[model samples]
Target: MRYNRNEAFRFAFKEPLHARFSIYEVNGKEVETTEGEIQLMDLSPSGAKTYTELNIPYTANNSVKITIHFQLNESTYNFKGKIVWKKVWSDGFMYGVSFLVNEDMQQEIVKQLKIHVKSLKN
Candidate 1:
């Protein structure tokens, strides 16, 4: 499947899921981490977009590795991602995180997204 760099095709859920994220590394240096809660807005094989009440004021195009933790089906899942974009709002920030996944992990994410889409249909 071909995707446009400018336009992203995301599966937006009606009820946003709660997730926690930690910025473990920045510019290859370990820093004091501030854990924050984010509302998972949408999902795709490539990445996800989330909204957080925490004000993470990072410059655009700044790269940082983060781990997002969320629960599904009584099991917790952690995914590694890189921050690609950050938009500041009056209350918080919206982040576009691109998943750093291998071929296998990509397939797994796609599978889970498909399941979520299917469940939403019913």
Candidate 2:
């Protein structure tokens, strides 16, 4: 089986990479909930495409704004993001989140991605 999507992250590391994440806020409101693991199928400095068991109902053309927390390269990161898109799959929900990060955070994300990639070669 093969994926035909011309996604950059898919070709970069050539392996499945996952990040444990929690949606800390929804629609600008703080949420008290359990954490859920999400597969970061596509990642970049500005955003990530993730697959997870978590689902935030979307209706009336409202956008889902959330604070996402995750760990990468032994460092924890928190990003405010908007669920730009979503789709329901067989066993999970796929979400495209656009991160609202500063320039420094974007650079940090890129750095971690590079570090992770280098680890794969070892």
Candidate 3:
């Protein structure tokens, strides 16, 4: 859960979400649109850890759109992530998701994360 850039925001949600990237999900799983799901772990803004799988659609520097649902209080926010990095591991593939653009929901998450960071700094 480390980022190369400290400017990236991190927020936790109350629940796990079903995310669909601009790529595609095969058989209700996350993967390259044409391929199958590759095991993933160690998620963060900068990168993640994944197991070895063939046809790893995403590359080290490929740009991707990651969509995940986020909820806080009574509001639910949909997130679109831009890929930063992807790495290969003996176990699987690790990936990174970056926020794409500004939306009201994203702004709220950013605001909250900023406050959280500020609190930590204090």
Q: Best TM-score goes to which candidate?
A: 1
User: What are the per-model numbers of colliding residue pairs?
Assistant: 0, 0, 10
Score candidate 3 by TM-score against the native.
Answer: 0.45
Assess the local accuracy of residue 41 in candidate 2 as a C-alpha lDDT between 0 and 100. Answer: 72
Clashing pairs in 2: none
TM-scores of the models, in the order given? 0.82, 0.74, 0.45
lDDT (10s digit) by residue, model 2, range 1-122: 12235422322335435666555666666766666677767678778777887777644377666667777778888777878888897688888888888889878887888787777789
Query: lDDT of each structure?
Result: 0.76, 0.69, 0.46
When 1 and 2 are scored with lDDT, the better candidate is: 1
Superposition TM-score, candidate 1 onto the true structure:
0.82
**After superposition, candidate 3 runs with Cα above 4 Å error:** 1-5, 8-56, 103-105, 111-122
In model 3, what is the error at residue 96, expressed in angstroms?
1.3
Displacement of the residue 29 alpha carbon in candidate 2, Å: 5.4
Best by lDDT: 1
Clashing pairs in 3: 48-94, 49-93, 49-94, 50-92, 50-93, 50-94, 51-91, 51-92, 51-93, 52-92
Output candidate 3 Cα RMSD: 7.4
